[model samples]
Structure formats: C-alpha cells, structure tokens
Target: MYKQLLITGGAGFIGSNFVAHWLAQHPHTQVTILDLLTYAGNMANLQSVADNPNLSFVRGDIGDKALVSSLFAEKDFDCVVHFAAESHVDRSIEEPDIFLKTNVLGTHNLLECAKQHWLYPGAKPRTHLFHHVSTDEVFGSLQPGESPFTEENNYKPNSPYSASKAASDHLVRAYHNTYQLNTSICHCCNAFGPHQHTEKLIPKTIHAILSNKTIPVYGDGLQIRDWMYVHHTVEAIERIITKGEKGEAYNVGYNQEKTNMTLIGETCSLMDKLFADNTQLQRQFPEATKAAEGKSKELISHVEDRLGHDRRYAINANKLSAHLNFSQTGSFEENLLDTIRWFIQQHTKVSTIDI
Candidate 1:
C-alpha cells in the first residue's frame, strides 16, 4: 500500500529478502534502502534487483540524525520499514554498548525523524506508517508448557540484544500512544533462508556439514525455537503494513518448532542425501567427506551454552493469521534443502569468503 518507501538495513538478511519481495509485488513503488554495510550486511544480497530503476541504495546509518532527516526532507516516504539492528546474541553479549547504540538509539533516531516529517505541526495529515520489524526474544524464554508469545505477552528480554530490541519496541509503542504516530511492531520468530550470515544456526549448521566441520550444538541441544521462512516474514510485514491497525504489535510465526539438535540432524541428513544422489558434489568438494558418505551427523559437537541462553522461543502468530489472514507456505523440509543448496551455490562463487 506504500508508495515511496524507506527500508533500513535493506542489505541484511530479512530486509534484503523483503526488498526483493516488495519490488516484485509492488512494481510501481519506489524503495530507498539505507544500510551501513556492516559485517552482517552484504551488497550482494540485492544483486538480483541491482538494476531496478525504482530501487535506490543509500549507504548510511539509521543513527545518523542529519542523514535520516535529510532523506525525509528529500523524499515523501509513505512508509518506513525499519530492519536495522545489532542482532547477534553472542556479539551483543561481548559488546552491549554497540547493541544499545544501534538497536536502541538508532531506532529512536529514525522514529524521531519520521515523526518530525510525517506528523509535523500544522502540516497536512500524511498517509504514512512506521513499521518496526522486531524479534520474539523480547518475550524471553518460554517454558515447555507455556503458551507461545503473543501480542499480549509482557516484555522480558534476557540478552543485551533482546533488551535493546525490547527498548525499541517500547519506543515505537510510546510514539504511537503519545504523539499519535502511525506505527506497527512485528515480532517474528527465528527466520532462515538464503543469503543469511553464517553465524546463525541454520547457515552455520549447513556450512559445517558441507565443509565437513564440527557442527556445534549448545548445552544438550534441547533449546527449541520456532522457525519462519524469510519470505513468510516478509509477507507478514507486508500484510501488517497494508491491513493491520495502527499502534498494534503482531507476532509472526509459522508454529514450526524444532530443537537445536533435531534441526542440525535434519540438515546433516539432507546433506548426506544430496551428496549420495549427486556424483558431481562428491567430486567438487572432496573435503566434504562426511556429508558425501551419509555420515555428516558425526560432525555434531556439543558445546557449553552461552550466557542467558533461552530454553525456548515460540510465537502464536494467531493475531497475524486471524486478523490479516496470513498463512505460511512451502514445506519446511523442502525449504531447508533449498536453503542448503543456495549456500552451496554461494561457496562455488568464492572459496574463502563466508556466505
């Protein structure tokens, strides 16, 4: 429904995917992508639509107040889909200051800028929205018998990363409540798909199996997390922006629950099957001895858990599905294989560069 849109962190995993999806779905809309190109952000993620005339890439920071305000002055953006953040839990633990700076302060910078431009005093009421893409970790770890995280759940973030996001969510809600700014917060479960950074669980596991390296599992590997396909997350964001009410938060989840061990084992099994079926795979990467021999499971390595590792994370997504009629598509097993193959293709492009 948005016309001229500003998408922060558009080169990151989910933001990049959403950019592609949005351009394809709304061909006439103009999209300006603001990214800092951090280690987790890659320019190659937008390679497919690099030539699209309607898509513009701006290398900048959300925390840069001058630049953000300048963009608002230049473009009459009807929507701001904020996806930028310092999201790695381990990295957040190591350096929480950066997380707070980017996740907390950076988000506030964008909101303040949007409020100034869209809700200016005596200005004509603009048809615009500020959609904040958040994570389910704000609800903290859920017990086995506990209900999935919903919009009504209290914020109980545990990690520095989640705490920062929790602060951002509150800010977005507060802006809506106090200043009457149109905002919607979307809390999505763990997203997995192509072009994701290798530090995440899915990509890390796939990379380990393909390279015949140790697949590290944390502390008994019983930590459960609900996985949502990246495109599904994009769809939820799109639907929320179009159909969802202002000043509301929606939890987007597929209800696909898998423990860390089970997910890794499934990846290993898929790799083994792929190698067994394709002789070229055996020849191309002879180093993948275990995966090619249907023995990738041997690479499973249990490690000590991290500080404040959540036992479980899930989202009900009933509000998203019921209100917006959002439903997940594709088979998880099939999508997992597709994701694994996409990483394999990336390896073929550059041998040493991490995907």
Candidate 2:
C-alpha cells in the first residue's frame, strides 16, 4: 500500500467520489487532492470527507509545472490517480484551446514531474503508479450494432476533448516505454451520479424538469451511450491502481447502452412519480402544500444536434474482469432508478443553478 497518494482533480464529481471511497477503504492511507476548482469542480462534493484526518486538499491548476513539481517533490506520492481534465464534449467544442492546454500539456507536466521523482536510477520495482482516468470517446463513434471498444481499438477521436485525452494517453504510454515509469490507464464509459455538475445530460435534464424549463434534446436524441454508475467506475479505478498490470490500458463500463431519448424518458417517469407522491403528502396536510404537481415531461424541447456527435459508444470489459476480477454491480435500469431518486431529493439544490 502507498503511504502517500495524490489524486489530481479530486474536487470534481468522479474524483471527489474516488477520494471518499479510497479513504473509507484505507483508513491508514494519506491522500492529497490537487484541483483547479473549475466550474465543474465543486467543493461541496467533497464535504462528506472534508473532516477526515487522512485527506488534504490543494487548490491549483494541473498545468502549473512549478506547483505540480513542488508537490511531487514535497509529498513524494507513491501513487497518482489523475482525473482532472476539461471533460464535457459540448464545452470542448466551444473552447478547444483550453482542452489542449489542460488535458494535454497539463498531463505532460505531471508525467515529467513523476518521472523525475519516482523514476530515479535504481528505483524500487513497482513502488509508484501513475493511473490516468480517460474516456471511451477517444475511440470515436461505433457503427450501428458494432462490437464494443477494446484496448486494441484504433484512436479516432472526433472532438477536441477526446483528441486531447488521446494525446495525454499517448504521452503516458511513451513515458512508461522510454523511462520505465509504472503507469496504467482506464477508459470509462459515460458516468452519472450525485455531485455531477448540471452541464451533464442527466443532471441538466433533472434541473430543467424541476424548474419548468425546456429540456433540450440535441438532434433526434438517438445518439447512444454506455452509461456506468459513478461508484462502479471508481471501484474499477481502485482495483486497477492496486492490482492491474503496469503499462496496460483497461476499459471500464456498465455495458448498459441507452439512447438519449430512452434515458430522458426514464428520468421524466421517475420525476413524475416523485411529484405525485409529493402531491399526495400535500393533500394529507394542507399546510405542507408547496407547488402544483406539474408534469416534468412537458419541459422536453428538441434542439439542434451537436457537431461531430458520436452515434454510439460501447465498451467490452473483458480485460478488466479477467485481470481485476471486477464486474458491474447493478443493471442500468436499477442504477438509473436510484439516480432518479437522488435527483428528486436534490431538486431544490439543482434548481438554483443556471441550466
């Protein structure tokens, strides 16, 4: 076990969850979180573990070479779980330069720092690990009814976000091959869970429905995505970092493929259920009445399709299962229902955010 672990981008939804999960599993381990706290990196996501004795937080950009190097030198982290990047595809379309800098250059800086600190001459074997968290977007879109993406899939990134991630993945591989740095990579499918920013599809839909705003469905809402629960992905990352083979890339997914339309409909149905229950409560107690039990589905609004939007994305998790003894714990339907309940509970909190 590593004495000191550094998790970059630890304030974001996935990173924050990973931190909370890691600390709970390893009480003796010390963790340092470095995050830039961009729009998506919410501090509230980490409030649950804020008071934990084993965790520490740092606010800074990953592209800052001096800051990253200083942290590596000072802390001498034995493992790095890198989750920081400009992740939203829509945002990347609007701003590609920011993606290149933060995702590509920022990763390069961290790799160099790790090389200098952990790859010194005669270093202990497998004493350090630099685990990069990436996405399946790097493989671009799959044809209709095609097989899922695997490690051997060719890189055909269509968006700036994915291209930047591909570049970082290459750099990580290069460092491992040339300098013998212990590195691993896991490309995951779309993730949804609590603490996710409103920019994402599920959260955005929830926010729109709750506030009586239009739920924008890009194009025909036929684009397919393999949705994985956030906790499941985090668990895969933990397993890979601890037990995966260095220099290997693993694909983590829930194998739960759903089109945008199907997902939106499911979300609307759950919201309706919650609203009906609330209405019943109001009837029982007249003073408890708040707002009318309005139908959330009325908010659906079709919008122009995004540029270069992939038609589908799927992942084959055979390697992850074979090597790490891992598999998804729940079906997409089960997880989606749980997610809907969570959103219903958080309606007030999400309503305040600008959709």
Candidate 3:
C-alpha cells in the first residue's frame, strides 16, 4: 500500500480508470497525475472524482525531465504507475517520432527521476516501485494455433506503436537488471470500458451506430484480441504492484478472445436493446429513434485494413493466475453491456444539453 504515488497518464482511458479505482479502494493513498492532455486524454473522464481529496491533477508532459524530477523531489512518490504514452497505432504510423519520444524517452525520464529519488549508494533496493503498464502487441501478431504470449516471448513488435512500447519495456527491464531500479511490468491485451476515446474500435463502433453513420470495419474484421475490461486490468496491476517479484514481467489477461466483427455485432445487439427501451434517449434524443430500428447491423462498412495490422493477439496468463491467484470475475458480455450503457448515458446527456 503506497501512501504517496505518482500516476503518469492519469487522464487517459486506462490511467483515469485506474486513478478512480485506486482512490476508491485505497482512500488513504495520495495520487498525483501527470498528463500532457493529448487528444486522447480528456479531463471529462475524471469528473466523477474531481473532488477527491487524495487526488491531484497536473497538466504536464512526462518527457519534461525537470518537471518530473521536481515532482519526485516534492512528493517523494513511493510508486509510479506509468500509463502515459502515444498509444494509437495509426497515429504512430503517421508520426513515429512522437511515439518514440513519449513511449521511450518519456519512460526513460520517469525511470531516471524515480532512480534518483528512490535509489541511494550502498543501500538494498527500497520498497518503492516503478510499475510500467504496457501492451501485449510487443509480442507481435500470433498465428491461428501459436501459443499465447508469455513473459518469455521474443520481442517482435510489428508497428511503430508496438515497437516504441517494446523499447520502453526493454528499458524497464534494463533498469531493473543494471541499476536495480525495483520495477515490475505488466502487458495487457485490448482494454474496453467507459471513458475510452471514440477513436478506439469499440467506442467508435458504438458511436457510429448511435449516430446513424457507417461503422467501419478494417478488412474482414476478424482480427482477434483478448479483451480485458478496464476494471480487471486495474485489479491485475494492483496485484502485480503488491506481490509481484521485482525485475519480473507479468501478462495480464482473462483469456477472453473476441474478433473485431464479433465484438461489433455484440455491441450492436446491445445498443438495439438499449435504444429501444432507454427513456433518456426518448426524452433527449428522439432523433435517435432510428437506433431502435435495429438497423445497426446495416451500418457495417468494410474499409481498408490497418497497415501491418496484427491478426491475433492473445496472452497466456497461467503465470499471472498461478502466481498471484488472480482471476477475472465478469464475463465479456456482462462488461460490454455495462460499457455500452455508460456510453449511451453519456451521449444522451450531451445531446440533451445541445437541444
């Protein structure tokens, strides 16, 4: 239980969710968030917890070494949960330098600051931690029958995004081995939940359906991803931070693999049910009456595939499960419904105000 913690990227999807979760579960912990407020980072996501006495929001870049060092010196953070990075693969493909800067150099900056603050000459490693949140794409795409990614899998990142993440992962391991920085890394599969940016697949699909627009599917939309809800992802991270061995990496997943098309279909089915019965939409967005018509399936639009898109990504979580005794409690469908409801409620609120 870290009393004073720094959470980088706390305004983004997973980061913001983790902040809310942490404050709720550990009310005594003080959290300071460092975010650049990039397009993906939205302050609206943290509205529910804006008044949290244990939370402080700072708008800054992790690459700013001076700022990070100052924060570490002032707050004396015992732990750092790094979630700040340029995460979108398509954006990375267009401009890879930002990804390298934020994902690699930004991570390096934080590691250096943490090392200076937490490490001292001729001292055993302290209880302080630097927890790195990463993605399974660092293992590259898995074939149909190939085994899921384990911690031992060779680094074969397929995109600028994944490669940048791979570099950061290596840096974390290097710091642990060479400098003994007392770090732990967890690589998760695709995450879906509330407050996710709409540019992402699940949220974008939901947005298209609700707005009577075409829902674009890249290629055949059969790309497989192990879907972990944001809450479960946070739980896994907490477990790793609390009990995981130093210098080790864990693959965090629930073994729930769903293809792009299947996920879209499930989301559309749920939306149809919600739109038909939602009183908020009837009162606020009568224009959304067509959503209840169940034509969301007709909105499916197959577009060009993502460049160098990985066909499948799965994680072998036997290690995480056996070692930590952790298990995911909710089914994908249950969580997906919960996520869809949140988005609808959010959209309805916005639409109501617009009218």
Candidate 4:
C-alpha cells in the first residue's frame, strides 16, 4: 500500500476530491499536497479534509525544479499522484505557453524528482509509483460513429491544452520505458461534482441560473462529452495506485455521454424544478428569477465556437475494469442530482454568510 503520497494540485476539483477520499479510506496514510492555488484551485475544496491528521499542504508550483527536488529530498513518498496542470481549453488557446510550461515542463520536473528519490535511493525494485492523472483529450476527438478511445488509442491531441497533456503523457511513457521508473497513468473523462470551478460547463450553468447571468454555449452546442462524477474518477485513481501496472495507462470512464445543449437544458430544467418544488430554494436564490419562472433556458446565448474545438470525447474503460474490477459509482442522473444539490448548497452558504 502507498502509505506516503504526494498529491499535487489537491486543492483543485478532482484532486481535492481524491484527497478527501484517500484520507477517509486510508486514515493512516500521510498525504502532502503541492498546489499553486491558481484561479481554479480553491482552498475550500479541501475544507472537508483540512483537519485530517494525515494530510499536509504546501503552496508552490510544480514547475519549480528546485522546490520539487527539495520536497523529494525531505520526504520519502511511496507514490506521487500528479494532478497539477493548466487545464482550461480556452485559456490554453489564449496562452499556450502557460500550458506547455506547466503541463509539460512541470510534469517532467516531478518525474525527474520521483525517479531520483525512489529508484536510486536504494536501487530498489519498482514498489514506488508515479501515478499521472491525465485526461481523455490526449487521445483527441472522436467522430460521431467512431469507437471510444482505448488505452491503445494513438496520440492526436487537438488543442494546446490537450497537446501539452499528450506531451506529458509521452514523457511519462518514455521515463518508464527508458529509466524503468515506476509509473502509471489514469486518463479520465469529463468529471463533475462538488466545488467545480465556474469555468466548467455544469458549474457555470448553475451559477448563471442562480445569478441571473447569461449562460453561453459555443457554436451549435452539438459537441458531446462523456461525463463521470468526480467521486467515480477518484475511485479509479485509488484503483490505479493500488493495482495498476507500471508503464501502463488506464482509461477511466463512466460511459455517460451527453451533448452540450442537452446537458445545459437538463441543468436549467433541474434548477426550475428545484425552485418550484421548494419554496426555500426560491428564497435562497432570489436572483434565480428565470429558474423560478421556468425560463432559465431563455438565458442561454450561443456564441462562436472555440477554435479547433473537438467534436466529441469518449473513453473505453474495459482495460480499467478488467484489470482493477472497477466500473462506476452511481447512475448518471443520481450523480447529477447530487452535484446540483451540492452547488445549490454552496450557493446557500454564500448567501447566508452574506446576510
């Protein structure tokens, strides 16, 4: 078991969720988080596990080679669950260099540090693991009728964000094959859950509806994304750390596909339903006038499509399932309902605190 872990970006959406899950399931395990706390990285995401005796936090950048090396020298982590990256597609387009520097250079720095500390420290067998938390976008887009991406899929990343991730993926593979550095990668599909940044589609939809702001969609809104709850993705991460093979990559998926338009419509409808059924929701989110009136969809404004936007993304989880006996956590609607409630709960907290 990986009793000592270095979880980079643990203050972000998926990483933070994984940390809380890890600490709960393995109360004896010690975890140190390294995060830059960028706009998307929120300290509140770790609130649930902030007081965990086995958890620690360090504010820093992964690209800082010196800092990362110093950390490895100080601690003998059994595993490194790397989640830090510049992940926003649009933002990557606007500033591709940032993506390259973080996703590519940062990942390399972490890998070099891990290899130095683990294998050479004792010339030990590969018991130590460097688990790279990656994205399905590295496999590029799928056509309408194309098969979902598998572990064997070819590299064809479309955007700057994905290309940087692909570069990191290749670097990881090279490290494992060349140096025999113990490593694994988990490629996850689009995930949504509590504490997601508003830049993401679901959270943006919820916040837009509650704040009476315009909900913007890109182009025709026909792009499809396979969605999974963050809880399921984190479970998959745990499985990879425990049972995954070194130098291998596993694609974690929920097989829940939904078009952008469809997802937005569903979220709008859910907001309307929640407000209608519960008078408290109406009072709590008074700015959600459109949702209370069942007109939340009216707020949707379709704009120009993003440059080189991928048409669809789907993942084949057969490898992860066959190897780890893992598939999913809950039904799509069940998870979606929980996510909506979580955001609403956050909204309530903010509003109450303001009052």
- What TM-score should be assigned to candidate 2? 0.93
The TM-score leader among the candidates is 1
Candidate 4 least-lDDT 10 residues: 346-355
Clashing pairs in 2: none
lDDT of 4 at 24: 84
Sequence-dependent TM-score of model 4: 0.96
Candidate 4 residue-wise lDDT, 139-162, digit = tens: 998999999999999989999999
Clashes of each: 0, 0, 0, 0
Candidates sorted by lDDT, descending order? 1, 4, 3, 2
Q: Write the per-residue lDDT of candidate 3 for residues 1-355, one digit (tens) a residue.
A: 6889999999999999999988888999999999999998999999989999889988999999899999988998999999999999999999999999999999999999999888867656567999999999999999999989999999999999999999999999999999888899999989999999999988998788777789999999999999999999998898999889988899998898889999999988887777666665555645555576866788899999999999999999998999999988867889999898788778767644321
RMSD values for the candidates in order, in angstroms, are 2.3, 3.7, 2.3, 2.0
lDDT of each: 0.92, 0.87, 0.90, 0.90
What lDDT does model 4 reach?
A: 0.90
Judging by lDDT against the true structure, name the best candidate: 1
lDDT for model 1 comes to 0.92
* Model 1: per-residue Cα lDDT over 77-106, one tens digit each: 989999999999999999999999999999
Put the candidates in TM-score order, highest first.
Answer: 1, 4, 3, 2
Which residue pairs does candidate 3 place in steric collision? Answer: none
Model 4 backbone overlap count:
0
Span of 10 residues, lowest total lDDT, candidate 1: 346-355
Query: Residue 213 of model 3: what lDDT?
Result: 86
